[model samples]
Target: MQTIVYDETNKINEQAVQWMEDLLNFAADKLNVAEHAEVSVSFVDNAKIKEINREYRDKDAVTDVISFAIEDDEEDLFKEFEGSGITIPRDLGDIFISYDKAVEQAEEYGHDINREIGFLLVHGFLHLNGYDHMTVEEEKIMFSLQEEILRDYGLKR
Candidate 1:
């Protein structure tokens, strides 16, 4: 499947790695992504995420995650790489999360860091797999999927 590759320049603990992998697997299973599919995620601070949100989305604030799907000729989420049996790396795009925000929200929500990271990972992965909360119905589906994934990962607190 399209695995979630983390950009670790921002510093990630072991739990962050585990949660990232788990959430990617969760999304792959639920989305029925093929073997060797690919996805990527980046952990950023509030300042970096705010810059991304503003530059790409024209929003002037730090947000949870943003998804940019790499479209193919057939408009499939993931593209097939050259001649390899593997499906095209989903290029599933990158997710930018503010560690500051995650930690802050975790404190506010009264949950462990692991659980909070798990939730954020699931939320970001869902966005990569074509999930969004831009509308009421979209939110229901996206959140339900996120909750289910997190529950499966034993992240609920």
Candidate 2:
């Protein structure tokens, strides 16, 4: 699993970026992602994320994270290429996280910044993998899985 991280805000340090990489690797292992899978994670400020949210979701409010899953649209197309001796890397998707919201949530939730960021990363990763919390049942399942993954990753609240 290759996780390309872009710190658009330039506020995240090297250590935080490295930790995110390690966390994504661990998540991929736990989720059984393909070895050739690739995902991009971008950290941006509130203004940028709010713009993205408004453009993509039509909501003017700032969101903590947003995921764009490639498989959601091109799953069948990729399946056709399977077993044809083509080694196409599974480009899962991109995840954009709001750095400002992360800091605020960390303080609000009474946890470290790493924990909040890790939670957001895992949440976005799950969304890329087809997890949704649109309904009550779905919320229970998705939230439980997220908590389990976070706990196992040692990012407990």
Candidate 3:
């Protein structure tokens, strides 16, 4: 999978960036996504994430991660391309992660920063793959899948 990661806040070091890439690749494999599947991940600070949450979700609060799924529409476009017998990669979506919140949460959750980052990435990746936690059952299912992927990736928490 093509995981384009950007550190917007300059807080993520090279090691963290490498971890994110590795986690993303593992997540793609767990989700059964093809190597051509494309996803963009951005690391931002709490202020940036809060602004995005307020603008898009009207939450006005800092969140660990946010995902925008563009695959459905892209799938339709891909079908049209298929008519022409031209294959195209899938643009899954964008994932925004708040490094500040991740640090805080990692401390709160009693896990390492890598585990926290992996959890956040997996959670966001599932959303890009059409998972949701709007209800208790949905939350359970989504959380279970997230944990499963993380555990398999050796990021148990």
Candidate 4:
């Protein structure tokens, strides 16, 4: 698993970025993602994320994190490539995290910034893998899997 991280706010340090990479690789292994899968994670300020939320989700409020899954749209495209003997890295999708919101939520949830970021990353990764919390049962399953992943990754609240 290859996780490309872009800290648009320039507030996150190298250590945190590396930690996120390691966490994502661990999560990918646990989730049975292909070894050559690729994902991009961007850390931006609340303003940029709010703009994205408004544009993509039609929500005016600022959210903590958002995910854009490539497979959601091009599932059949990949299936065509599968049996063609072409080796291509699976582009999972993109994850945008609000750095400002992360700090706020970390304080609100009584956790450190790393923990909050890890939670957000795992949540976004799950979304990329077709996990959703739109219904009560879905929320339970998704949240439970999130907790399990976090616990296994040594990031617990």
Candidate 5:
């Protein structure tokens, strides 16, 4: 059971939400996950996200999206998850998306807002799933997965 909660109304990003569901299911299939998971996504303004970033990460900037992974601290949460190949989860976490930034980026990139939202949702989901761009190779894999999942959901270019 995956739950998506918004901090505010997201009446505009319906396509992105649908694509996110597709991406989540694709990832679960690829990872062989079969259990309940909850993820919250917040549509916040730039100021709110900037405050969150500064308070949590000490970064005084408004980012596009942010994800908080609580599983990293739960030792027993995945006692045999990797070995037994089982998906056991209750609440995955939350994904905070800045709509202001998203709109700006969409226009700057000359792409549909839906595509930009899809990209952001995928990026945030990757982070929650333990994907990071700390290195070039890691970045390639994460980004590749992002594009692949989006393409799979018919979110072209």
Candidate 6:
């Protein structure tokens, strides 16, 4: 799978972007996404992320990461990736990350900004792959898989 990193704001550093790319590539490899599968990661400011969160999720808050899936219908989402008459490379989804939030959270959590960004990217990718943490059970599964992917990628806090 290919991950394209875009900096909507000039806040993110090159190292962070490169790390994001590596983390996403690692995630895609572990999750078994198509080699041609495309996921876009945009680094934005808190204002942009808050706007997106309000517009898409109906929550007027600034989140560290937000995902926009291609297919809201769970059943049809993976079908597009199966190459069932689909000609183009699958556009998995878009992941928006707030650089400001990443920095803040990293400092708050006592971890490096790289690890926070990696976590957000992996979390957003999982959401794109039909993972959610709304409930207790879902949280357990999603977080466990996330931690596993991060550990396997050698990105630990």
lDDT of candidates 1 onward, in order: 0.72, 0.93, 0.88, 0.94, 0.78, 0.87
Write model 2 residue lDDT over 1-157, tens digit each, in one string.
8889999988888888888989888988988989999999999999999999999999999999999998876537577777899988899899999999999999999999999999999999999988999999999999998999899989999
Tens digits of per-residue lDDT for model 3 on 3-51?
8889987877888778788888888888888888899999999999999
Model 6 lDDT per residue over 63-85, tens place: 99999888577566555447566
Top lDDT: which candidate number?
A: 4
For all predicted structures, in order, the TM-scores are 0.82, 0.94, 0.92, 0.95, 0.82, 0.88
Query: How well is each residue in 1-157 modelled by candidate 4, as lDDT tens digits?
Result: 9889998998988888889999999989888999999999999999999999999999999999999999976547467677788989989999999999999999999999999999999999999998999999999999999999999999989
- Residue 19, candidate 6: C-alpha displacement in angstroms: 2.9
Which scores better on TM-score, 1 or 2? 2
Residue 7's lDDT within candidate 2 is 91
Candidate 5 residue 95 C-alpha distance from true site, Å: 0.4
Cα RMSD for candidates in order: 3.0, 1.4, 1.6, 1.4, 3.8, 2.7
lDDT of 6: 0.87
Q: How would you encode candidate 1's per-residue C-alpha lDDT over 1-157 as one tens digit per residue? A: 5455555445686766775776777667877865666677777778888898999889999786666666424354333554666543445666667777888889999998677767877787777667789999999999998888788767787
Q: Which of candidates 5 and 6 is the stronger one according to TM-score? A: 6
Q: Considering only N, C-alpha and C atoms within 3 Å, which residue pairs clash in candidate 4?
A: none
Q: On TM-score, who's better, 1 or 4?
A: 4
Q: Considering summed lDDT, which 10 consecutive residues are worst modelled in model 5?
A: 7-16
> How much does candidate 5 score in TM-score?
0.82
Q: Rank the candidates by lDDT, best first.
A: 4, 2, 3, 6, 5, 1
